[model samples]
Target: MSKLACAAEAGMLPGMFKRVVVFWALLVGAGWSAGLPLSPKEVVVVYNANQPDSKKLAEVYRDARNIPQDHLIGLELSAEQDISYDEYQKTLVAPLRKTFDDRAWWKRSKNPEGLIIPVQNEIRVVVLMRGVPLRIKPSPLPEGVKVDPKDPIGGRTESAVDSELAIFGIDGLPVQGALKNQYFQSKKSIREANLPFLMLTARIDAASESTCERMIQDAVEAEKTGLWGRAYIDIANKFPQGDNWLEAIAKKNLEIGIPTVVDRFNDTLPLNYPMTDASIYYGWYDWNVSGPFLNGKFYFKKGAVAIHLHSFSAEQLRNPSKNWSAGLLERGAAVTVGNVYEPYLHLTHWFDVLHDRLLDGNSWVEACWMAMPVTSWQGVVLGDPLYRPFLHLNGDGKMLAEDKDYLLLRSAAMRWGNDPEEFNKQLGMAAERLKSGTVSEALGLDLLAAGKDTQAAVWFRNAKEHFEKAEDKLRQDLHLIAIDRKAGRKAAAVQEIREAQARYGPMPEAKALAGWLDILEPPAPPKALPK
Candidate 1:
């Protein structure tokens, strides 16, 4: 059995409780309103007053997300991405908190001694616009402060600015090795909806201000059009922990019926294999994944979520057209999760959890925060917090006529949409292979390549329903969900998951489908008000 099997068997997995109470609690709008993603109005934008471009970038983002002008807070700070801990406390954390307090952004109360208790914070997300520093080098502990035994590195440490925001108020507290995320997987811990907002921050920074501006625009478009495309997962067989996490991610994608390609090798996918229409990507352990996709000219679908796991992968994002996170942004990915400093192996975000939660319909911020084990550490979430990729997969999973996936697929495969001869050739080829059940799938592929995706989707389904064996048919059904996603027919794909569950009985994949279906379901009706 795999580690996941053991965990599930032991019932130690997060949110595994089958009880009604647990389910209902989790079902509550855990940080989201019904039919809405995280609102831009709830976000505060931070920029470095020291950099003119930073202010300009903030303005562009505000326009894109409709963030209020008052939400933009410019602080006098260094242009560099790395800073000392003292500098962070003095310049970024302390000053920002003071501004929030003075502006009455949220309510706080004080005791007789007059120490304020942060009762309610309205700002759920802090959007670090371009030019803000990315990390803080660990400062030495104060005299008489004992070292945390958890510091396997013997007191040396560093922190990501986004991570430290989880504990933005605890600036003067004694330094520990790292702060474990208390709400890491707590279904009830999403205090954003009813209580004070804490943790959860995203940054918009890249090689250039224009790139940052473009990211904001792309995210808005993706949310409007839907996040429908392929997923590419690459794993470097290095440490067991990292490898296991990546493998789990691929496995979960397969279980959730996402169209996916996984490459487990020392190297990444070669440049020649087309990676067009990719909406999701995760790869790791190396400083960077070398591939054609890295070039600024390569662009994924508008709402693509891409991340390369590496120490210091997010160390800088000022060059909108180059290096790590910024490079991905320049190349058109909307979301990038990375580290700003050496987080060591155990402190990084778990890719498996990230995948599962996103599929569960959690917005990017909620999903990222839930998966991250520690805050006040090295991880940084870079994207729009309210972007929910799976929101497109709701209801009957039927593809909407307006879904961008249809257009994206048409653009990539069907020159037939442009050329009549290509359309005729596909029609001719599809007819020839329809006679052989085993070869019928090839016909669908040919049609899909010619951009006759609706016809191709029908053929693929027929191959599964009529020609494929039980096990093979089940797999095909899952793959068809990917096709459904690409064609913007998520309602049909969701129905496929239901049919598959009935056919397979209580299998692992079936159970995963049930869980995902819950995520796709609308929030439970609000409890009746008190009589």
Candidate 2:
């Protein structure tokens, strides 16, 4: 029967028969069709065309894989709209979904076996800014209290005590246990008497360096009420003894169950060499060796989807040479050529290639690390408007390089971070870049890491998109077959399982997702007993 006739007939069937018959017809028809075989898995990718480097990088992936021109989808975001988070999501994500949904190839078919996988691609840009200053209120002082500068205890100590008393007034002793409860009262009295001006000035000009000490003591006393137990403990541990400041702080905080420094406290320390561990410190060290220290930790916490080249030795940076960067890539990283007097030239070359591949709507991931200099010169340069997103690393105090090449790399990374739309775009790019039929297979590994069957199913669909060739198709099929057996998607997840087996052969993930789907989907009704 003709496909349209079969479709019409299947549509006429009542209830579940229509769905079952349609699916079977499509499967049988595909076996007889003369067209190129479909892949079991699918993939999608997203990118910003405004970034020349990103565009270039996509191209390189495409050329390397020999993807067809028509298969790629390039989505460009305007520079003005790209800077705003809301604008990027609305302008980019919405159009992307529409483009895929509108494709004729994705429409439901009469053939029972045919499946249409839904995927999306998008790109985003990020802009960075400097830290804003905190606002602090003035202190207050008591009346009829005069400072004696010549006293051993110091004029500042007496002034501060007097201020505390004035702020608290006669109600101070009674409210001692409920410091927080009394705080507003004290503040109210200080404000009413306008005692802040004199007390603040005296505190600032104090001869004795015991203000911090006194503050700690008062805080400790306040904790007796248990109203500020945790806060009091934390405040007391800020100052640590011993020559090694980092170790001391670490020890002190550890005792109080606070593993990291407070945001406000971190601001007080010098930007460079802030932490005690010099070798592992990100801000103070050179990028090549020191970069990994920060990268590893950042990836552990924030889950970096892409990686870049930093300051690895010359031997580790090149291909067809003594050093190999693939080890890092294998561990979910990407490298850029480093140490060239003109790093941008090399970076631009790679970016061009990557952009082309992404444009093809294939499945692929790119990584790059910039070797930012730890100098004020670099900071000043990065502060310019052009390098907004690449201003500084999250933990590092130094600014990133402001050059367009580096900025492009930084922009891509930030765009991908925690953004679902951007991730879908990259998946599309990965789909088109499967050489040796390995892209889909490789993606299965990442899907497993995701720990969500639905998400893995989406990724599998992306893998199948570019797997039209027999070898690529078969490779993807096997992966799906495996996924089926493990995840038990025998029914609901049958689409993914069957696709994987059809394209790649067998897949553990396909089996797993299928098993899970079966468990989730209700069982079919038993045959009628009456006969």
Candidate 3:
């Protein structure tokens, strides 16, 4: 039986008593019965009930897993109470404790052997901020500072209202005060146990000018309390100004020692114009500004480890070509090149690929690997099939593949060839010999021709992998470490460097990689919170 089926059966089995009785009977009748291997437990998703989006978010978990409705649980919290921060803490502790207890039980039931597996591995909590503003601030408005009356910015002071502020935090001094207290208390409880939590802070009044300040303040508070490891800011559009705002908050969080995250691309595209041109959409200028942020050096320097680059459509890549769409692989490569940041690209194109067969309905995994060629920044000239027409008989009357030295010459001719037949012939020969060592060498040269450092790293990796399989350890070791270092695997690359040093004595490149890794590792976790 499959592992999932076994898990489902185990879950469907009766209580402990019944299971024990069956085990006893099996033991008596069959003399010995092997214990079943445990199934990988399903993830438990929790969201606040009060938020309208709460159900939708919870549904995402269920729909993703296709689990029975009963498997999902929703916890609803009352947003009506107006109390001091301390009182709010007292009010939430009891219910939160109950939820924790229930979660523990659910986790325990999944493990028939009673092994103490981490609940986080099986439980994911999506804390929806209901009736909370996207941003928070100290009340008692400054003179002449009126909360917009038409907006009724504070109308939901007593009951939950359909205001954007209510989307993230509560209204009025008391409700807002209560939420702050609850937030810290809950954070303390979760962090004390070293639990992971995801906070999606959204506001109804997302476009309002004051929202940015509140987001910044809240981030500062969260960092101070160690409440969340990751923070997601969801806004209406993709404004460059919005990115600037996030950069500012990321800066502030770093100063106070907080790991702040900005969830770009969660909403619609922010730009007013259509992003259908590769030059316009994946321009290097925007990346030049954002790249430093990824390297932990831009506006505010914090030892931030990673950032997420999400793209909902391949259309976001904006390739005019009909044969190949500019997908995450292309965009990611471009972003990495332009900005020198290696952020994970969340490709939403797989959904379209699966449903529409736009890209042969290849699973996301296959798509990712196919895109790896692009991600490695190898230009389309080498990989695209359209260039196959250029391989014609030379004056000396020799097929291009007959001589290794001629590969680059042939590729160059194909790249610059005017006639479709000549391009296709050359491309065909190159494509046919893709796995040949000569072809690999030719690809490396092509990358050099393109002056793509990142693509050189990829070629190095491919060459190393092939050479290693043929027992060429020295060449394999050299190229693998080089590629790893170039691709942000600094620590892994360092390990390879150390191995090389031990194996071959002090090599210059190995020593350099070691030094670079030493500089790249983040400082040890802070001993005490920043003053």
Q: Name the candidate that leads on TM-score.
A: 1
lDDT of 2 at 404: 18
Q: Tens digits of per-residue lDDT for model 3 on 1-531?
A: 332233233232233224333433443354321112111132333344676554554454345335446444455544432222333334333444355566562232223454332344233222222222111112344356445566432322222111111111111223321121112212121223233221211111112213222322332222222121222222324545434534444333323222222223333222211111111012111221222122211121111111222321111112312112222222211111111112122211112111111012121112222222112111111111101011111111222222322323332342434453443344334433444333343344344333455664565555544442322233335445545654677778778756765774543223333333444554577699678
Per residue, candidate 2 scores C-alpha lDDT tens digits across 329-385 of: 222221112221112222211222222222121112111111121100000100011
lDDT of 1 by residue, 1-531 (tens): 322332234332143213312322343324333233566767889999988888998888888778889999999999677888788888987888898889887776663555554567767778887788888877777678676686574465577878887668542444546777765764432553443636478888677766767777877776654577667777878789888888787666543334455655465544323354477888875555456454334577788889888886777776543447766777788888888778787788888788777776677888888788887788889877777766544211233332322322322222333454554344334334333233344345545544677776676676565553453354445446656645667687678768777887843334434544454454689899999
lDDT score, candidate 1, position 326: 68
The runs of at least 3 residues in candidate 1 whose Cα sits more than 4 Å from the true structure, single-residue gaps closed, are 1-36, 108-117, 148-150, 192-197, 294-297, 319-323, 395-531
Q: How many residue pairs clash in each candidate?
A: 14, 107, 29
Ranking by lDDT: 1, 3, 2
Off by over 4 Å in 3: 1-42, 67-73, 76-94, 106-531
Q: Whose lDDT is greatest here? A: 1
TM-scores of all models? 0.67, 0.19, 0.24
For residue 246, model 3's alpha carbon misses the true position, in angstroms, by 18
